[model samples]
Target: MSTMDKGTGATMRQTAKARRRQAILDHAKRLFAASGFRAVSIEEIGAGAGISGPAVYRHFGSKEDILAELLVGISEYLHAGGAEIAGIGGGSEGAGGSEDAGASVGVGESAGVGAEAREGDPAGVLRRLVDFHLAFALGEPELIRIQDRDLSALPAEARSSLRRLQRQYVSLWVAALRRHAPGLSEEAATVTIHAVFGMVNSTPYVVRRIDTAVVAERLRTAALATLGVADVVAYRK
Candidate 1:
């Protein structure tokens, strides 16, 4: 066979492999979210992904491996994305190369925050952070369900890594909140941040009942209000 032919074949094979791997992850995420992780098996996941049960092992070591990728992957995405919007390096240098998690890849800007947001500006950081989070909360509620219900199912190392990334992500918001509302004690800010997370992450429960755009606006408003930021208005889509 010609070298060009071989190269094209190799590229096609890799593309197919990549698609299959993503299919497994997507199906596994849905199954794990719909039924708790422990109750779902590799066979079930493979079936959902349109492959035979044993074919899954070619892509992942075990069910827990897939779970780790889903959980840890999103965590990494969130951390890296937040780090970018906040205009700083990630919280820690680690085995994965950076801190992070997430689904949608862009930062949304609220009308109140304006379009000329510069990096390192506190209000700009906070506005982008809020929109960044809202995008995830609304776009990937299933991951939230898996996180809430199945985190303990992860291997110890994976669990620790996920938690570490989460803490780092939260710290980004805490810093922004305190920077804007300097009157808030650290404890108060921490508590409020968790509250906002709980409120936004509750999308899994309530998202189906409302228009997603409306939900995004309300959540943005409530989050900013809870954090007591008066300068940024709730962004309307």
Candidate 2:
């Protein structure tokens, strides 16, 4: 094959591999959410993903590896997303802003705030964080359920890494909250952030019963309220 054709073929294979890996993760997440992690086997996950049990090993080392990737991958995603929303760089807590940070953190920009104001405004940041989290909670309730019940199923090193990433994500909220409420203590901010997370993460149970849009709005209002912000109406869709 020509060089260009060879490159195209390699890219296609990589894309297919990624899709298969994601399918396995998706199936494993749902199964683990329904049944406990220890109760779910690789054979079941592979079957759910429409592959033979041994085919799973081509994507992951074992069942525990799949669980580790699911949990750690989401944690990393959250950490990176929080950093982006907060206009910070990489995994560090340093001061830097993304080029599109304003757009990313403007979930409530409809309130007539300019991009400049939305970029690092504490209220805008908090509102944006709420909206960002609501998207994940509503769309991936299976991951939330799995994390809630099966986090301990991960190996010790993976669990520690997940917790560290989680702490960093929480710190973003704490920073934003303290910026909005100057008098708030670090302990208070951390506690309030966790409370909002618990409330938002509870969507897996109620999503089937209520309209997702309504559930999102209500959670947004309650989350802002928990942060002592009174202007949820401005952020309403």
RMSD of each: 4.1, 5.5
**Candidate 2, after superposition: displacement of residue 135 in Å?**
0.9
Encode model 2's per-residue lDDT on 1-237: one tens digit a residue: 899999999999998997788788878878888998999988999998889999999999889888887777666666666666766647423212222221222221111222423465888778777877777677678777788888888999889888988888899889989988999999999999999999999964666688777888788888999998766575463
**Each prediction's TM-score versus the true structure:** 0.86, 0.84
Candidate with top lDDT is 1
Consecutive 10-residue window with the lowest summed lDDT within model 2: 102-111
Model 2 misplacement above 4 A: 92-120, 232-237
lDDT of 1 by residue, 1-237 (tens): 999999999999998997888889889988988999999999999998789999999999999999998888877777766766665554334524332223221122221222323534566667677777778788788888899999999999999988998898898788777877788888898999899999988963576787887888788888777877653453332
lDDT of 2: 0.75
Report how far off residue 23 is in candidate 1 (Å). Answer: 0.2
lDDT of 1: 0.76
